[model samples]
Target chain A: MANILGTNIISSLGFTTEENFQTVKSGISGVKHYDAGTFGLPEAFMASLIDKEKLNDSFSELSIKNSYTGLEKAAILSVFDANKQANIDLSSGKVLFIFSSTKGNVHLLENAVSEQVCLWYSAKQISRFFGNRNTPVVVSNACISGACAQIAAIRALESRKYDNAIVVGADFLSKFIISGFQSFKALSPELCKPFDKDRKGLNLGEAAATVIFGKQNNSRIQLKRGAIRNDANHISAPSRTGEGSYRALKNILQNIDKGQIAFINAHGTATPYNDAMETQAIVRAGLADVPVNSLKAFFGHTLGAAGVLESIILMKALYGNLVLKSLNFSKQNFENKINISTENHFSDKKYFIKLLSGFGGINAALLFEKR
Target chain B: MNFKNSAELTELYRSLQIYYPKFFKMDNLSKLGFLAAEHIFNACTDLQSAPDCTPITSRREPVEPREDIAVICFNRSASLDIDTQYQKTIQDNDNYFPSPSLFVYTLPNIAAGEIAIRNKFLGETSFYVTEEFDAGQMVETVENAFSDTSINAVLLAWIECFERKVEVFMCLVDRNSKKSCIFTEENLKYLAINIKFA
Candidate 1:
């Protein structure tokens, strides 16, 4: 377990964690419709894409422009803002940087697949951007990468080998990603309605989020426990029984009381299979009565950033005694009896669970508690 | 079982006579890792058994479905080999025909998934992409996996397939075993270096 030092999120909704939280709290969505001619795609789509102009303006404020890619810029901006609040020395080898993304510098593939397309190289560049001396760890495990990277940081901090760990998860929309999702027929043409009766597929979004973990003496927030498990069922499809996700939740929830959990922040991507499968896992884990919410309707699925970004928002809500709503959830389509609401609620609970599932039949759970 | 490039992995699979048809659908990186795991798991049959037990050389014996073995793999390229192929399908708008079959293999962890699907071992599987093969990180990662207490063994691997060349060094680390050589950074480096030369 480690202390929650600082956090930041740069997305289409806003720039800082608080800003993005407030935006979602106000029930404002960032999803926009794009025609086939827009963004060089072959079909109409909808996603929460960060404004290139706003990102450039925010990044230009740094005043030291070495010309990094879009993904790199987002990552640097997030890390810089989060470290500013954490007040840690990044140059020290005791501080490790973990970058999580499904694809890094993937846009470079439009020209050729050079060394620049390597995820590790982009991780190194992001690490060196702050003079971090230790080797950066890259987690590219599809959608669960952000949470998996946090678990990595937790393990590293628990080992006492690092004084602090800065985990940043970032990914941007690209023709490569869009076309692939198009091939899978996984894009929603309108704003996604997660867990609703008429819910279609997921919409891709762009964002970069950071969560700093440190072993401090008087830390208020603690990462209680986390687990990652594989279903060993299929590569691209989720398990029919939600085996991996259930195992992950069961492992992390061991010895913990279900009464203290304020809510379960689910990876509700709005896709038919993902939503149904997630509800199955939630109910199977005995969290059927817990208030669950999905932020996909607000920000779309941010891929790697979804885990960390959503965790930050939920943690903030936990501190504020607020249980945010799962926007666009109209009717219960799935058979699971999991609790989901369209309006916000109040809770004085001290603990929350962040759950995510992704490709490769992998599922991850992170438990956070207010100390 | 040494080959100069990844293209010969199909030949290696054929020569080994492993009858898994899904093997052909995997990308080169997954094929390299899948073949290496096939070799390692075949050599040591009783991974969960006592350390003093003799190693079995069974060809097609069905293995038990264990949930304590984790697949912790490291790679340098991180599926760039397949990413490049996926890129070609969508490079030109007029010629865009992105194949979902090819896009599914773009992740490095899918290789671990392929291994897990075949063995039915579902503990904790993760994939880390390092700039290079660092023995210290490998040893640390294996130790970290063991920290979960439920993970009794790890299928540790350093699978790198890029530029048509493949280099894989996979070993099984059983927490309950003491009869074999010790697991250390130096020993891991030695094995990794030897495999590159082999």
Candidate 2:
């Protein structure tokens, strides 16, 4: 069994996991309109930007010269928390680092191309900062990279390849991401309303999340079974019948009792197709009655970081018995009858499943049981 | 599974051309994967009985709707477009003008995607980035693919494409067979020795 040593969150809403939970539990969202003139965001006003100055101050030596500053800070905090919780010396353990991000310091690359920077470093910069010289794996599988990285870490641990694996998913809002979303016509001008009948599209957000998985005697959570499957149906679109997601769900449900699963964190990107597809998958999994919530409304769509950030939030909820309300979810869609939590409902249940689907027909699902 | 030296590779390619002439003319990575896949396809012909004269493609058709046949491809080095991105970044004064064409090849799994697209094999595709080629990971990935009964075969390819040169080694694994053909340490040693003289 692999235990989550600890997790950290760095986003516009909160810097630490505790702060994020408090804000999300109270249904407080940090998504707002930006002047764009300040960051040269063009006409796009809405975004979730972390405090760069604060991040720089906290990680002075780490250097916040790029958009990955928040990600670096989040990684440090997560490792620190995990080290503290596990009470083990990381210097002695075999550290396998897996960095997940769709946009890896692309702003730095942009700046470098513009003659503002010197080099275009990859995601290895984060692992190098943590003194992890071992070959770090960079997973840039678009949006689902975060969850895919987690599943990869779990498999590596289970295979006895490494004693501990640090899985990090981080992505920040950039002109490239914004432009891509615009190209796809997937950005919402207004706040995102996941599962709501009137939901238009996803509101982009930025954040970095890190989770440490280790084999230990005392673990707060146990990663039971996980699966990564592809839809193979469409490259940029989700399956209309949710076959890929349903298969992934079925793979996870086969090992564990579906009724024991207390809460499900749906991918619910607030996009019509994604929400509808995930809803259908949930219903087909016979989890139609299970309480489900989407964190996109709280943090907007963090893209690559969505899976790890949401999983970390669910971990906190499982530890503290806190069920965060799904913000902006009012009315249900006709596709599924799942209970959408609009108010915080604490539960003592142990097992929670997190699901994510991304571009290229990649679908991944993970099950975490409280210890 | 063992590999041949340059001479052996030439022979293997010649042998493969007899069966798949179109694929043999492609890039080295494509040729390697095609060669390995042909071996597996030929091996599975007996168990999955069809007319002896039937073409391999006809026999390899998907029988089940949910059948899983994943391809996990790994490549460490950058593609030819890496130089293009670098040149653009240098010439344009560091403005983020990453060539979308180049960026698509930045990830290693695109090679597998190309193969899958060409073959019409709709299955799970994953790309893993490692500092160096790892036999353990290759075995693990093949094992994971085989663990699922639906996944009949996995096309495991390790390719490195850079400005200097391109090197690729690919093999196909099926759960039903215990025979080892390519990518084994013994084969690597044999190829290394042969290539040292070649």
TM-score of 2: 0.80
DockQ of every candidate structure: 0.80, 0.17
Highest DockQ: give the candidate number: 1
Interface RMSD per candidate (angstroms)? 0.8, 5.2
The C-alpha lDDT values of all candidates are 0.86, 0.66
Q: In model 2, how well does chain A match by TM-score?
A: 0.92
- Candidate 1: tens digits of C-alpha lDDT, residues B1-198: 566765677889987787899998988878888888888877775665334434434647765555777899998888888888888888888788899999998888999888888888778889999978888888887877777767778898888887756678888888764225488888888877776622
Measured with DockQ on alpha carbons, how good is candidate 2? 0.17
- Displacement of the residue A159 alpha carbon in candidate 1, Å: 1.0
TM-score of each: 0.96, 0.80
Which digits, one per residue and each the tens of the lDDT, describe model 1 over residues A1-371?
Answer: 87898999999998999899999999999998888877678788888998889888888887467568888899999998998889998889899999999988888988776777888888888898898878898888899999999999989988889999999999999888888888998888788988887898998899999998998856666888888899898998898788889988999998998999999999998888888888999999889999989999888889888898999898889888899999988789676678996688899988999989988878999999987
How do the residues B115-190 of candidate 2 rate in per-residue lDDT, one tens digit apiece?
5544545556676655456565556656655544456666676665544445566555555442344545455445
